[model samples]
Each structure stands twice: as C-alpha cells, then as structure tokens.
Target chain A: MKRILLPLLIVVVPVAATVLWAWWPRTTPPERVSDLYRRYEHNPHLTVAYIEDFPVNDTLTVDVTTIRALDAAGWDTLAKDFRIEPLPDILQKKLNEGKDLVTTFLAPKVNPALSMDTTDLLKNNVVGISQLIHTVSVFSIETESQINAVVNYNLKL
Target chain B: MERKKLKGKELEALLSVAAAEPDGLPGDVAAQATATGMAGFDAWGRRRQRNDLRRRCLAAAVVSLLLCSFASVTAPEAARTSMVVNNGTPRAQVIEGVRQILEHKL
Candidate 1:
C-alpha cells in the first residue's frame, strides 16, 4: 500500500494543480495609476536650477513662459533679502532664456546671523535644501547675513 | 454432492467388515477429502485479501488528491502601478504659429 500510494500521489498532485490553475478564472483587479508632478532644485553655486518630473505628491501644470517669469520675480526678491547678489547676471541670463530656472541655498534665508550651524536647517521645503549648507558656504558667503524673508512662495502656475 | 448414509442392515454389515480389518482404506479416504476442502477454502481466502488491499490503496490515492487541491488554493493579490508623465511644453515653432494666428485676427 505504501509503495504504490506514495508514487501515485507525487505524480498526480502537481498535474492536478497545474490543470486547476490554468482553468481558474482570473479575478485580477484593474490597475490604478498615481498622479504626476513637477519639482526643481538649485545647484551648488546657485547659478542653474535643475528641474525634473517625478511620480507621487502634488501635481503642477506649468508653461515655460510662466516658469521664466516666476523665476525672475524670485531673483528680484532674493537680491533684496540676502543683501548679496553674487550670481545676479548669471541667474538673470538663465531666467531670460525661456529654458532655465533659479533657486537659492542658505536660502529661505530666515535669520540674519553672521555665522550659523547647518545641522538641521532647510530640511523641509519643495527642494532638498539640506545639502546646500556646505555648497552655499563657498565664495564670499562665509556667514549667512541677517535677512528677514518668507521667500518660500508656492507659486501655483 | 450427496452421500447415502449406512443405516439398519447396511450399518451392521459395514461395522462387521470394519471389525474384520482394524486398519482399513475408509479412514484414509475421509482424511484426504477434508484436506482437499481446506485447501480450496484457503485459496479463496487469499484472493479476498488481495481484493481488500487493492480497495484500500485506491481510497488512499483519492484522499491524497483532495488534500493536494486544498494546499494549492490561495487568495489573489491586487494589481497596482505608479506612472510618470513628461507633459512637455509646446515647441517654439508651434507657439509662434499660434501667436501669428491670433495677431492676424486682432
């Protein structure tokens, strides 16, 4: 009984399962797609703003002209707030070209302290500004000067 | 099969004969008949046992098939996806053409 029964079960079980899986009606649900959105980030020198598309989060529908105008307005506010306009000509050129964008690091320039620690500042924003403390500290920006501004404008295009 | 039993005068005659010869062929004939009958019965018993074993094996195989199906079945998972869209802006030429069309109407 044991000899015949063991071999019969081994062969039959897999064959029966494969047949059942093939005949089983598919009850798979429809696929749901998430919304797409836009975001931009500033470079180390604060000259060029790199923009790219990513999945999830808030969706933004913006034209190139609209982006250019918004960037110029942001540059003007940046000049007034930080009291230092090192890359004005370069940023203005990029903004005028209809292709590029501009952003600031040491940005959202909250307090006017001459020297401040960059341990946990500028972490929560549209851009990943947490990495800019080292990059923006170069050139003549030894200490982030006192600049009072809520420059984080959520310009909905 | 039927056998005539010795009774009355027949039984007396057979008893007398058996008395004449104490060791006779009659006893040996009876013992041989019993042995043949037992051999036939034994053969039949062995055949029935084989049939019973075959039935048990078939029943076990059927039960194993049912259990295999139970083990194979499982709950299905849901399908989902994430998508990225470029939605590129209008080309410079296309925008210029649209602008030209609007300007002519103005």
Candidate 2:
C-alpha cells in the first residue's frame, strides 16, 4: 500500500497543480484602482480635458493639435512623468501634419514585483482608455458623444 | 590437327534436327516458371500494402502533433480573466479606481 500510494501522490499532485494553474480565476483588486484615483484627486495639476468622439471602440486617440498646443515646456513635463524620453522630431512633424497619437500599454508577466491581478487589469485584451491609463475608473463605459476626462496635465498650451 | 568447320551437309542435318524439336519450353519447366512469377507478384503486393500502411500512420501522427501544438498556443493564459463589476458596484467606483491607478503609474 505504501509503495502504491507514494507513486500515486507524486503523479496526482503535479497534474492537479498544473490544472489549477491553468484554469484559476484571476481578478483585479478594486481598491488599488480606487486608491490611484484618490491620489489623482488630491493632485493640484488635475484638469478637465476633452476629447472629441470619446471612447471610440477601445482606442485612446489623442489629437495631435492638442499635444502640440502644449509647446515645449508642457511636453517636457509630460515626458518626465511617464518615464519616457521626449517625443522625436518625426513624431512632432507628424503631429503638426494633423495626426493623432495613440499609445497602448501591455500587461506584465506574472512576477513578485507585479501581481497577476494588476497586470491582467492593466493589459486586458479589450482596449480602452482605462487600460491605457492603468486605471479601472472607465471600465466598460462607452459614449456615443464626446466625454471629458479629469487629467493631471494641460491638454492645451 | 587442324579442326575442320561443319560442311554444308553437316549444318543442314543439324538444322533439320533442331526444327524437329518442340518450339516452346518443356511443360514442367513452364509450370515452374509460372509458379515463381506468381510468388514474386504476391510478395510485391504484400510489400506495397505494408508501405502504404506505414505512410498513412506517419501522416496521421504528424497531423495529430500539429493539432496539439495549435491548441496549446491558442489556449488562453491561466492568469487572465475578464473584468466584471458586481451589480452592487457603482460605475463611479470603478472609474475612481481606474483614475487612482493611472495617477500612481503615470
């Protein structure tokens, strides 16, 4: 009995663990998203920004004109906040040509630094402004009309 | 001594003897040859059948392997799930949550 049970446990345990890993339900913590919003609320730079035809089917399209209006100073500030380099000359030229800038953020792989829940919510396959912003505030809500967003940066110079 | 080639009479006599013999192989030799031919054909047929079976099984295994690979690649990741807000949860709550997360990250 001992011989039989030992091998059985060894085989069954791994198989069960694999199944659990594959099929487990993953979710985002609501509190994390809420806390982010609360912090934004307390920020002094927050402003109400508008985008025409908002929430156009999972795409976050920022008007190039709006970004250009930021001039050099505002643009530099934005670049610093996002932890990315300043926009290239080619991108600025394109923006001047009346184009929209779209950016998408992907979820991180499972790791200790980034939890599965946070990554999953941030990088859900469904494209939305919320996902791009890494927030849960605008989840599943779409508007046929233009909408306003409370943003921390000036959309116009 | 120098050997003499067959004379015209000698050659004629040999030809007459050969012409008098049967035109086809002897009966027993013909039967044995036919039996050998049939056996060869049978062996060839069996070999061809085995080769065909082996090719079909190899093709099936390759197809099964391809299908398994496709299924594994296309399957959804284990940790990803759809975001569904509870009925009791207000839309404002979700929006606030998203805003906070973005503020921290950005």
Candidate 3:
C-alpha cells in the first residue's frame, strides 16, 4: 500500500497544482483590468487609454467626435444600464446654457491612502476603465491628453 | 531380480575407483549445468530490461498528458475574461445602448 500510494502521490500533486494555477479566477481589480485590455487590444476599431494625475482634479472632457461615435455605436443603452453619475452642477449649468462640455468621464475622489502608485494606476485601473468604457460603447473621439500619450507610449512600437 | 551383496574386497575396489576420479563432474555434465545456469540468468535479465522500459514509457506518457492538460487550461485566460464581461450584456445591446446615449446627450 505504501509503495502504491507514493507513486500515485508523486504523479498527482504536480498535475493538480498546474491545473489550479492555470484555471483559478483572478480576483484583483488590476488583474481583471489587465486581462480585459489584453483581450481587446487586437481589435482595430477599439482604442484604449490610461492617465495618471497628481492631486484630485475633477475634470473630464469628451470631444464631439467621440460623442458622435458613441451615438453611432449605440452606447446609450450601456450608459443607462450602468450607473453613470449625473454631470457636475457646473457642467450641468453649461449644458443648460448650451455650452459644449469637453470632459467625458470623471472618477470620484479616492483616499490618498488607497491611491495606488502612478505605475500601478496605468497598469491596472486606467487600462481597466478604458477597456470597460470601450466594451460598453464604441467611440472614435481622440482626446489630446496625457492619457493618450501614456497609452501610445505603452503600445508596441 | 535377486539382490547381490558385494564382498568387502569388491566394495573397496568400487570406492578406490570413485576416489581416483577428478573433483569436477564429467565434461558433458559440466557443460549442461553451465548452460542451464546461464539460461536462467539471461531470462531474468531480459525480464528486468522489459520492465524498466515499460516503466519509463509510462512515466513519459503521464508527464506529457499533464503538460497538455495544463496548457489547455491556461490558454483561455482572455476568452474566460471575455465570457465574464459579456455574461449578462450581449455585445450588440451594449453597442446600441452607447449609441443612444450619444444621440440623446450630444
């Protein structure tokens, strides 16, 4: 019995470990986000971006081209299904006055303690959001922002 | 047949003849004994070699099978994420929803 069990154990343990390592679901936000980006990076129609900023700055701009593309791509349903916070009062007032708002999305304040390093922000959260947005909607708007630079720099040369 | 008992002199003569013979068995008997012994060794050696080959082949097969299984399981990470993303929201519906938001807001 001992002889039989020893050989069986030697064969079974490594196979089981390899299987678990390969199939285990990724739980971290960073892992999920990176995976999402890799899956969609090959699509020519989609573009992904990431941005990092020091201090909490509440500013977002969405260009007309992007808006039009979102409209054409049929993103209204995604926005409705997902929880999209209303535009800030200032932006709302501008909208009421018929002023074009440039910012497209703004994230709420994050605690400094919870704030990840700039590298982590780019690798995980930023790319994750970009992929999430693209998955929900299709947009052709190109914004001249730091995110564009960061994303382009990260792209394969 | 009637049993015949040898006289003391006859018995002495037979013993002397046996003692005078060489220590080793006759040539034909020795050759036969050596051949039988070697035959047993050769058979055992062949069986051992076959068993070793069989064990090695089984090990290689097990390792290959394990590697293939691991590779197959890991190769679908992207596909797995995509499945999770699109679980409830169909791609077409998401796209349509985005388009509506653009039209209404812009």
Candidate 4:
C-alpha cells in the first residue's frame, strides 16, 4: 500500500499543478485605444505601457502612460491633451477631499547630449493613503530634441 | 528409484537441473525447502525495504519544495492597490485618454 501510494502521489502532484497553471487565466489587456494620442497609438514610434485594475476583481487602478514629443511646444500640446482627461466620479471625490495628490518625477535620457539630472520635485504624500507615490514624470532631452514624459491616472470602481 | 543419500556436488547438480527444467523441482523437494523456512530471504527483504523508503523520502522532499515554489509564483497577489504595467496601449484606450484631456478643457 505504501509503495503504491507514494509513487502515485509523485506522479499526481506535478500533473495537478500543471493542470492548475494551464487553467489559470492570464488575460492580456486589449490595445484598442483610438484617437487621443495624436492618432498615433498605431504608430510604431508611439510606445505605451499601461496597467490597470481588473474591473471584476479590483477597485483601484494606477495607470501610467509615457509619450514623447519633438520639443517644448510639442510637450505643451501633448501635456495639454493629457490634462483634459475626464475624471472618474471616484477620482473627482478624492479631489474634493482637499488632499493634494500631485507628485511627478523627471528622469534623464541615455544620450549623453540629451542627459538631464533626475528631479523628483513633487514628492508629497499622505501617510495614511498609499505607499506607491508619484503620478507624473518629465524627461528633458537636449532643448529641441524629443521629450519623454509620463502622466499617471488613478481610477476606481 | 532406490533410496540413495546424495552429498554436496550431486545435490547441487540435481538442483541445477531442476532450475534449468521448466518442471521446477519434484513436489516432495519443494515442500521440504518450504518447511525448512526462508530466514536469509527475510534479511535481504528488510534491506530492500529500507532502500525503497529512503528513495521515497528524497523524492517526496523534492516534490514538496517544487510545489512550494510553483504555488508562490502562481498565487494571485493582493488587490488592495493595483499599478498594472501594461505594454502596447490599444487605440481605444488612447482615445479615452484624449477624451479625458478634452474633458479637462471643460
């Protein structure tokens, strides 16, 4: 009995684990955004990294997207485009709570000519709120060169 | 079939012949060996049992360790705060971003 049981468990454990892994859902978010990004969400040059909460299982979402532009003028338009984003009702309520939630950081580019010192100027936080900080980032690469910046948005259901 | 007291080599040869033949030994000789008992076989059996148990222990330990690692990696993390790292933004999402920007204009 012992001989039969041990070997059976060995074979069954890994197979069961594998089946569980196969059944686990690892869904990728759809990349079907349209129009807001200079209509360049389709452009190979426009790279975006997004992470949001699953509506079915989660409530809080912190979405950070970074985009690049040709110069300060381009930055203005792009930043303006982002600023006009609508606030979800929950986010609006947070803003109404009299809490200053803005925090942004700046990072340097790889090009020596484009490199700039890192400045995380906006680093204020509410100790009781969250550990993850910062919601915006600006990258200043040589005066007229492309600027890569990030803006984070929070959403809740 | 006269009764003959066979010794040593003769006994060995007879047993070898019986082993080589499909008939096994005659029923009377088989019964005699069984009646005498199997003390030597029992000693070897215990040693084999010990080795089997040791092998099982090692295998079980390795399997449990692997299960621990797999569980940790596959387990779902807490959803208290989510900062999903999404790559390759979809067109519809960007359009949503633009919509938000437009709303900000209001």
Candidate 5:
C-alpha cells in the first residue's frame, strides 16, 4: 500500500501542476493596453487589439445594414435616407447606464477611401451622453474637439 | 464481420456513394445477378475503406503540419496574455465558437 501510494503521488503532483499552468488566469490587465499599443505601433498587420469588459454573455452588435457603399449611386441613396440618430441615442443611453461598450473600427489605412463617416456618425451621435468611446482609424473621437480632426482626416470612402 | 470505424467525412462520403449506387449493377438486373454481385460489392467496399483511410491519413498529416507551423510562429506570444476571459455563452462552448470564428476569418 505504501509503495503504491508513493508512485501515485509522484504521477499526480506533476499532472496537477501542468493543469494549473494551462488554466491559470493569465490575462493582461487593462492598464497595459497603452504599453502594448506602443510596442506594436510599427506593426502594420497588428491592426487593432483592445480588450472590452462587456457583460459576460452580450454581444458587441454592429448593424451594417444601414452602411451604404461609397459609390455615387449609394451616396445619393444615403443622402436621401441616411439616418444616424437612433443608433447614437440608443448607444448613449446604454453608456449612461455604466455598461461597458467600446468599439474601434480599423482599416488598412486612414484614407478618404475607407469607411470613416459611418464611425463619425456613431461618435457624434453618442459620446457626450454615454460612456461609449468610438475610435475610428486609430484616431480617438469621443471629444467634440477631436471629432473634427477625425472627420477631416477621414476620406469619404 | 469486423466492423470498421470511420471518421466523420469518410462516413458521409461513403453514405452518399452508397445512396447513389444502391444497386451495384449499372442498370436494372435480374435478382440472381444482383445476388451474384455481393462478392464484388465486398471487394469494392474493402477498396473504398482503404482509400478512405489513405485520404484521412493524408488530411491528418497536412493539418498537423499546418498546426505545428502556426504554433511555432505564434507560440512565443501565446503566453503573453495573462487572463483569457471570454465574453460569450458557456465557457467551453464559447472557446470552441471563438476558435471556429477565428479559423474562418483568418
């Protein structure tokens, strides 16, 4: 019995340690995001990486049905029927309630040929009223002052 | 009769082919001829089993190679994340769902 128990302990100890190592709560804390961003600044393919502490089961939903293609025909249709009022207002309301919702839209580059206006509409629509922060094309657009730089810099794509 | 175990894709392929050629004869044949084809059917079935095994082994080797290469490239940064919290459904299911989504997108 003593010999059997000694061998069992030897096998079990390493197995338990490995299990703990694999499942350990190994996550980067929120504060280190800035550090991470600086580290990957030169990385073009690195794209975007930011953590959101959203409610456990809820999805960060983005309804792209209203997003019109940046063609002349599409623009005409959007100018006639483009509505950004409801989404921003709804997002503002959600933000005021202390819900965690941060969405960043990124493309290969910030140009007039990229979809930036839609994100602007989202930012102008909700930031003051809600805690939601909308960063578009690497430029932060939560403030009224920062809004113009993003709007001007963003190509109409 | 030794029953052979088949992986998911192989089983589907076999089921589809079997459904297509339920009767081994090219056209409608006499019952006697159909009965005589049982030996041929067994031979064809064995050939298919061997082919399926070969295909599965090749697929497995390719997948293993791809995974090993990917891991070698990414393994350094795998430990960089300290806390891996998933914001989805059941924990295990969410991991699988996220993996599928990443696989498709990547």
Candidate 6:
C-alpha cells in the first residue's frame, strides 16, 4: 500500500505540473478580428471582415482583396486566420498572385516595437477592407490591419 | 486534263474582277459557265459559310466572357462571420451587439 501510494504521488505531481504549464496563460494577447470591430465600431479603419459562404458547384469567384493587401502587410501571424482549407479555383489564382489572406485566428494588436517588415511591405497601401465572399465555401477569410502601417510608413522615415 | 496555274498578274486581274463582280467568278465570259461556276466555288461558299459561323461563334464567346467578367466584378459580398468573446471586455460587448443585430434580423 505504501509503495503504491508513493509511486502514485510521484506520477500525479509531475503530470499535474505539466498540465498546468501547458494550460497556463502567458500574456494577454491582442484582440481577434471580431473583437477589434466591436471595440472600434464600424470605423472603416477597423472591422471584422470575412468572405461569406461560397458554393461548391457555382463557378462564380469571391475574392477578398483585403487579405492580399493584409498579407503584404504581414499581419497574417496565426494559422487559424490565414489558412484556406480547400481553396476555390479562382481565389487560388489571387492567392498565387501574392495576395495576403488568412483563415487562421490571431490576436489583432499590432506591436509597433516588434517587426516592421510587414509595415514596410504595406507602405503606401490601403487597409481595413474586409471581403465577404460566396463563390466557394472551401476557402477561408483573412484579417487585415486595422490601423494601416502604410500610413505610418508614409509619415515616418 | 492538265491544270493551268494562273500567273500573279493574271491572278491579280482575276481577283480584282472577282471582288468587283460580287459573284467572285472569273471576268472571261467564255469561262463563266464552264469554270465550275467559279473555280472551286462550292469550296469557297463552304469556306465563307464556315467563316461566318466562326465569326458568330467568336462574337458569342466574347460576349459571354464579358458577361462573366462583369458578374465576377459585381457579386454581392457575403460571409458567415461570427464573433466569440472571452471575459468581460469591449470585445465581448461588441460581439453581443453584433449577435443582437443578427438575431433581430432572423
């Protein structure tokens, strides 16, 4: 009985600690797309954007130009916000054309101090235009920059 | 019978008359009836008919292509967007607002 109890405690403690470590929240990340729109309202500069349900049979294409522009900006951090599970034929063309789109989810806060690569890429470019598409449903939506870094690029050296 | 190939100058004269004549038959009156009506005229007629058909088909293809392009440019923007908020914050507050708007419509 003693032997069994000691072994159980040894296994349980480590398992619990591992679980806690895995589950523990590190820092409060930025908001997601939906949150940004809600917090900012429909300010145009910020919004929750997505391409709507696209049909499997219909050949009509629904392109979210916003994602391409955003991809150019480098805000496509999370896989949930950038992946298109099974992309449509036409949308795939745009994606191939260096269009930045995300089907994955990511915290929406832009860390100015972090990296400026995305911002530099999007310099002089527009932002906050969300696509609501419905040509094919196999595709996904991507998040655009709420406050365009291009605007900053225009101002700063 | 041996075939007589017309010279460039003769072909030019023949072509000029053919264009002006409308029927595209040779200018020589003696050859009119016996030149197979117009030297492979059946073949020419078939060619013209095929060309007309091809032109019409090409025009139709162009129109359909234009219409599809227009439709692609004009489709309504649609999405199945939902918001999931965590904890009590503006994010949650806004998601609630959006849900309310959606629910009201439904």
DockQ metric for all predictions: 0.02, 0.06, 0.05, 0.09, 0.04, 0.01
Compared with the true structure, what per-residue lDDT tens digits does model 1 show for residues A1-157? Answer: 5546655666577657755664443321213211111221221212221122211113421111111112444444334433434546765565466432333333222332222335645321221111111111111121221111112223233
**C-alpha lDDT of residue B60 in model 1:** 66
Clashing pairs for model 2 are: A33-B97, A34-B97, A36-B100, A36-B101, A37-B100, A135-B98, A136-B98, A137-B94, A137-B95, A137-B98
TM-score of 1: 0.21
Using lDDT as the measure, which candidate wins?
4
Which ranges of candidate 4 are over 4 A from the true structure?
A1-27, A31-40, A54-77, A83-157, B1-22, B25-33, B36-71, B74-106
Ranking by TM-score: 4, 3, 6, 2, 5, 1
Over B1-106, each residue of candidate 1 has an lDDT whose tens digit, in order, gives 3433433454445445445653562764334334444344344545655676567667766666766555454322111111111233233322232222212211
Clash count of each predicted structure: 1, 10, 20, 18, 6, 22
The superposed Cα distance between candidate 1 and the true structure at residue A83, in angstroms, equals: 36
lDDT of 2 by residue, A95-148 (tens): 567553443233122221232245234332111222222222222213211122
Model 2's DockQ score: 0.06
Superposed model 6: Cα runs more than 4 Å off = A1-157, B1-33, B37-39, B79-106
What are the chain B TM-scores of all models? 0.36, 0.40, 0.39, 0.39, 0.39, 0.41
Considering summed lDDT, which 10 consecutive residues are worst modelled in model 2 chain B?
B78-87
Pick by DockQ: which candidate is best?
Answer: 4
- Report the lDDT tens digits of candidate 6 across residue range B47-88: 665675566655555655555555444433221222222322
lDDT of 2: 0.35
Q: Who wins the TM-score comparison?
A: 4
Each candidate's fnat, listed in order, reads: 0.00, 0.13, 0.03, 0.13, 0.09, 0.01
Ranking by DockQ: 4, 2, 3, 5, 1, 6
* Model 3 docking tier (incorrect/acceptable/medium/high): incorrect
Q: Write the per-residue lDDT of candidate 2 for residues B1-106, one digit (tens) a residue.
A: 2223333454344334434642543464334334444344345545665675566655555655555555444445323232323332333344343333333333
lDDT of each: 0.32, 0.35, 0.37, 0.38, 0.36, 0.34
lDDT of each residue in A57-137, candidate 6, tens digit only: 223322111221123222332122433244687867875775533221221134212223344432221222122221111
How high is the TM-score of chain A in model 4? Answer: 0.27
Tens digits of lDDT, candidate 3, A50-102: 11121111253321111111332334432342343457788678667765433
Task: Name the lDDT value of residue B42 in candidate 2.
Answer: 41
